[model samples]
Target chain A: MIELHNVSKVYNSGGAPVVALRNVNLTIAEGEFVALMGPSGSGKSTLLTIIGGMNSPTAGRVIVDGIDVYSLSPERQADFRYEYVGFVFQQLQLLPYLTALENVLLALAIAPTPRTEKIARAYEILAQVGLKGKEHRLPSQLSGGEQGRVAVARALVNRAPILLADEPTGNLDRATGMQVLELLRDLNGAGQTVVMVTHDPQAAACARRVVHILDGQIVGDTVPAPEHALAPAVLPISQPAIEPCSNATERVQ
Target chain B: MVLLVVGLAIGVATAVALMAITEAMQADVAVKMDEYGANILVVPKANDLALSYGGITVGSAAYDVATLSMPDVERIGTIKNAANISVVAPKLLGAVPLMGRPVLLAGVRFADELRLKRWWRVEQGMEPSEAADALAGARLAQSLAIQPGDEVEVNGRRFRVVGVLAENGSQDDDILFVDLSAAQLALDKPDAVSLVEVAALCTACPVEEMVEQISHVLPQARVTALRQAVTLRMETVGQLGRFAVAVSAVVIAIGALVVLTTMLGAVAERRQEIGLFRALGFRQRHVGRIILTEAALVSAAGGALGYLAGMGAAVTLAPRVANVTARVPWDPVLAAAAVGCALVVGVLASLYPAAQAARVDPTVALRSS
Candidate 1:
């Protein structure tokens, strides 16, 4: 579970200070698929960044599981994020210089798995994301939908508990966006807690719960009916725990 | 990386070349100093008129005819630091008419003169074997159309020229060498010597004290130490070495500045990449290590290439610049030190830039487009 209490963020630029989030309080439980709805300049992304421990709130207490994440040192918070959270950005932040396989492997670079196990896990995640044969393609070579799949593969490579996605489908076409939304819903069905911020109501409709934000405060939180959601039959994304690579291919060639 | 390597290479090459040339020059200077013989000269105390205008000696030099006795020549050996004296050659100078031209003759002991003038080269035959045998100077031999085994009349006596001395662009090239006793007998000045040339180990001994001792024993003779000429030669060589070092230091500073500025720009350009690394769980020290590793690789390669280029420069340019025989001294310690200096410079130059890369805020860096 992730909890945010009295979260506030103030941008202290040269001119008048602008508050991005004000005294926001929210809680997300395990296996919950929550979509944050807000217009431009609302604090949905800021709240997500705070929840992910990627950014510090000017005033807040963020508790993940039983421990207050904000109370830990900055380095400890980064480690907490690395172990507990996987981020998928709206812009589809795949490193341009690295290939699709390498992009997914980055999450495993700091993982405790053996080098060969990391590669196998990375390959499994890419296969799960529907990018089996395109693993070696650079971002520029992949289509918009393919790149989006690569981003999802990177987030799922470590199998972290909570996935924080900001507008994951905002840049895709309608069909591709639906495909990505379906992927998220499948992952949510498999017991991964997901908190997403999206401007498209159709995108939000795929989630089980919706929270509306205006200005810097949450206005309403609601759980939509299952029939009213736009998602197709929610298929589960089952990724079995993989076995370690055999010693024959154990060394990283 | 290319820019960094190029900058470091320029600095390393300059430093290595300077050091190599300086060492070569110092070695050459040592050999030249050894060859610098006759640090003191003892001349007869006489009222002499050296009638010269500009640089050319006009008419004949007139002397009071005062000469040093054989006892005065032997007294130089008993000076205070007399063991420091290597050679004391007594010489007699006279002018003789030969083949309708006046030729100057120098009378010196063969062994003492050879020891005092290590640079002198004999082109033909050996030194005079008897009083009647003479060694003709190169220019005198050429002008008289004389060679070894040729006989020339000097002071109404036939003297055989046993050898021809190589030209040295000095007064020795215009004079003939003979035995002191022969000159004294031929000139009718028995038991008299003109002056003495002494080669002393001035660097290891107190030459000034030796001069004072010699003067105290023979107060009438002038004993000059030739300190000005020696000091001038050494000072010029030392100045060249200092100048090379100063120029090298300035070049190194410029190279470091180039590295600093280039690294700063690179850090600025890679702000988003650094932020991504931080977001991926890299510590600040890890980020710094990545940057420092890049610099180390570039600097190491640059140092190696620069060392080669520096040796090439020294071998190609040292002789032309300092007129010294030059070779790249093969010393592994020196090579390692040179490369180590380059590595230090590269690391130090990247310190602020690496820190800047590590200090980037993930929030700001990730937010930037």
Candidate 2:
């Protein structure tokens, strides 16, 4: 569950005020998969960051899971992010030096879990994201879609309740993008909450609920019928099948 | 990392080599100074009185002269700093009539005298070993036209000249030396001594302290330290020590600057990586620890290698640079201190860079690709 009440963000760019968001009120129930759709500079990415607790609004408050997100100290806010939110940064921001498995493990680096258990959990998440055999490959060695899956695994590895993704399939081909979107739909079906930001209609169609924004304000919210949603793409015969992330919510938590 | 290590190594190496070479030179100069002559002189106490007529001061005369006895020379070794006394050469001086002219006669113990004045070289014949044998100074031998086998009569006593001393450009070239007992008998002043020349081994020996101790033992005698030689030796050693300290300070400062600049560059280059870590929920202290730990490791390695290289350089260069013959030995304590100081410097130098890294905004991760 997430709630934003009349949130607004302003950036001071060389003595001039630039408004990124204005009077935004939004809510999403638990386990909901929501997509934010907008044109470039429409403030969708900014809204995603604000909801993930990575950015503070210039005015108004953000409440997530019943607690005011910005009321805590900076250090405690980091703790809150660790406990409640996971971010899949745009462009699949995987550290180049680390392997796919290691990149996933970074999410749990500060966790209190035992080192062996953390490693096991990272491996399990990588497998569910269809990267079991490619765990040891560096990001440079993996395909664009595989790298995106590694980013998804990293976000889900810590079992945080909220997943905030920015352009998860932005760099993937049509078939590869369909696979990644289907993975998100499957994760949502199992009760994991996902909020993604995208400008692509085809990518946004994969979500159960779509919120359209323009000029820093939400203009439309809709639930596409199951039949109207983009159907899963037919895979080429040579393409590898991705493992379905069934029961991910229970396993991840 | 390699640059940091090399910078730290250079500083430590210069410090160690300077210390080793300075120590060797000090010891070398101390030994050479010890061989030069006696540093302390003990003489019979005397009072100077002006010899004047009614209103005109004609000259000065030494009154109440207390002659030092052989017992007083023996008691000079009883001081608290006696261990520093390398040689004690007692002498008796008097004027005796010889061949229609008055000549200065110095009675001395040849063994102790030779040890005290190491620079003395016998130009002809052997050292006088017999009670009836005597040595002549270069000028005295020239004036008397005496040979090594000639006989010299002094105070109606006949003595054989067994050796002729080389010209030393000192007052020693104008005196005749003989056995102390023989001169005591011929001068008819048995058990009398005029002065004592003490060669105190002054490597770490405190010359002033030895002088004070000797003065305490022979209260009736005037104990004087030849401060010219001691002060020169001390000043030379002190200058070397100060030079070492100054150079070490500069080298350490440059080394710290090297570390600081290199770490700052690393933080600047790793901005996106640091932002990523911050976004991953790593605390500020965690980021700082990562940078500091890297610095500590590199500096520790540099310190150890620097110590080895420094000692090797000292051993190879000391003889040519400082003219020292002693081999430089490895010092474990200095090694530990070098490594410890390098670690401390490295950590301190990296602090600002580490803080900069910790302050990196996590939002940069969202902005940067």
Candidate 3:
């Protein structure tokens, strides 16, 4: 579970201060698959960053799993993020020097597990991500959809209860985006709390709940439409024509 | 620039340490041998085994003398390496009578001593060609209260002290030079002599090789090579220079590895790009640690090149040491290069920062700015 109370974050840009988030109160229960939606500078990603302990809030407090994030020391906050929070980004971040299996194992380097068993568990998670035969493949060899799957797998590998993703499907076309949304749902169904941000309503529609953010504040949150369950298909990024059928309305500038 | 400065400083220090002591040992031999021109010795023939320091031994014995008669000097002068010879007049070196104790007196030949004039370094005395003048070693003359025109009684024969031998040190310090006939008569031995001296050229041969050559030429006399006394000291200093070269090579290798590691650090700390790797699940470090592994290989190559350059500097500067000839001493350079290539650079370049990259949190890394 995660909660934020009256949170305000300002970035000291050394010129005029940029207010990233302000007066935010939010609560995410256990096993919730929630989507956060906003245009650029609406603080969707900033909110997620603060909740995941990546950036500190300039005012107010954040609580993850009942532990006050700011109350803990900086190192302990990092430790808390490591043990409890798993993050994904619009750009999948992987170690180019490590193979698929070894990439997953890296999430476990600081985890409390013996090394031999850590390696074996990494293989198991890759198989769970439907990459059984691609465990040793380099990331460069994988397609965009496969890369997103790898990111999802890495986020789920440490078995953190809360998964935070920023712009998870922004770079993907609708097909691949839908496929990635299904994977997030699959993890959510398995009792993981996934907080994902996207501009697409169709992508957000896949979530059980949708939170819309604008002007550094939460505008509205509602239960998503049930019809959005379209088939959990293996969406291909090669077919980006599917984007318009999803969230074609969102635009900034 | 820092490495070259430090390495050259160490090299100069090593050269000074090695050259100073080796020169001193050689100079000591020259000073001691100048007192007696016995470059080779021959005594009532012993075994073919070489003597320890110098001179002939009758059945493992040692004797000291200053001059010999003409026949013995003539016989010994025919030796191969023996370029010149002198009839050393045996000065029965006994103490002169004084207030507290008798002083050491050495009887030398004032006449016919100029035959080996090249060997003597005169400080304050008439040359050996003077017959009526007897020169005491300067220090010996001071100790004995005797100088030129000073009268001294030896064996109840009153003689004027006419000459004092230059202070070349060792035997000359306490010895007196006079006529050969006068010394032999005062010592009570008309025909028997204490020893003879033969001065020889270097011949560019080691002492052991020259010993047999000298023995062949003087079957009944003893031969001593003064150069061998410093030969072992030179070998010791050569070994020390080799060790210094090895240490410098290792230090240079460490510097190269440090630079390689710093570059690797720049690569590891760029989290945004590495996040792309994590999302792709490339796991590059697991694929035999290729990027980091290349760092070590590059550093190893640098170390080899640096070692070559350092050795070039050592060779160029070896002759700069006073009296030290330029000898490459190939064994040390080869060993130091091997260490620079295999041991120093290979292990240190990739280990630490690569481990840091390995521990980067892929999940948080993707979200990092």
Return whichever of 2 and 3 wins on TM-score.
2
TM-score of chain A of 3: 0.87
CAPRI rating of model 3: incorrect
Share of native interface contacts present in candidate 3: 0.11
| lDDT of residue A117 for candidate 3 | 88
What is the C-alpha lDDT profile of model 3 across A164-214, one tens digit per residue? Answer: 888888878777776777777777777889999877777877776777788
* Models sorted by DockQ, best on top: 2, 1, 3
Tell how far residue B72 is off in model 3, in angstroms: 15
Error of 3 at B268 (Å): 7.5
Q: Write model 2 residue lDDT over B183-291, tens digit each, in one string.
A: 9888888998877888988767899999999888888877888878578777978998899989987888888999999999999988888877777777788789889
Clashes within 3 Å, all models in order: 0, 0, 47
Better of 1 and 3 by DockQ: 1
Q: Write model 1 residue lDDT over A1-253, tens digit each, in one string.
A: 8888898999887898999999988888898888888898898888888888778889988899987988888778778777888888777778899999999898777677899999998898888877888899999999887888888888888888988888988888876777777778778878888899987777777777778788999887766444443332332323322222111221111
lDDT of 3: 0.59
Interface RMSD of each: 2.1, 1.4, 7.5
Question: How much is B185 displaced in model 2, in angstroms?
Answer: 6.2
Q: Candidate 1 on B271-343: residue-level lDDT in tens?
A: 8777766766666777788888888888888888788888788888888986886354755665786688788
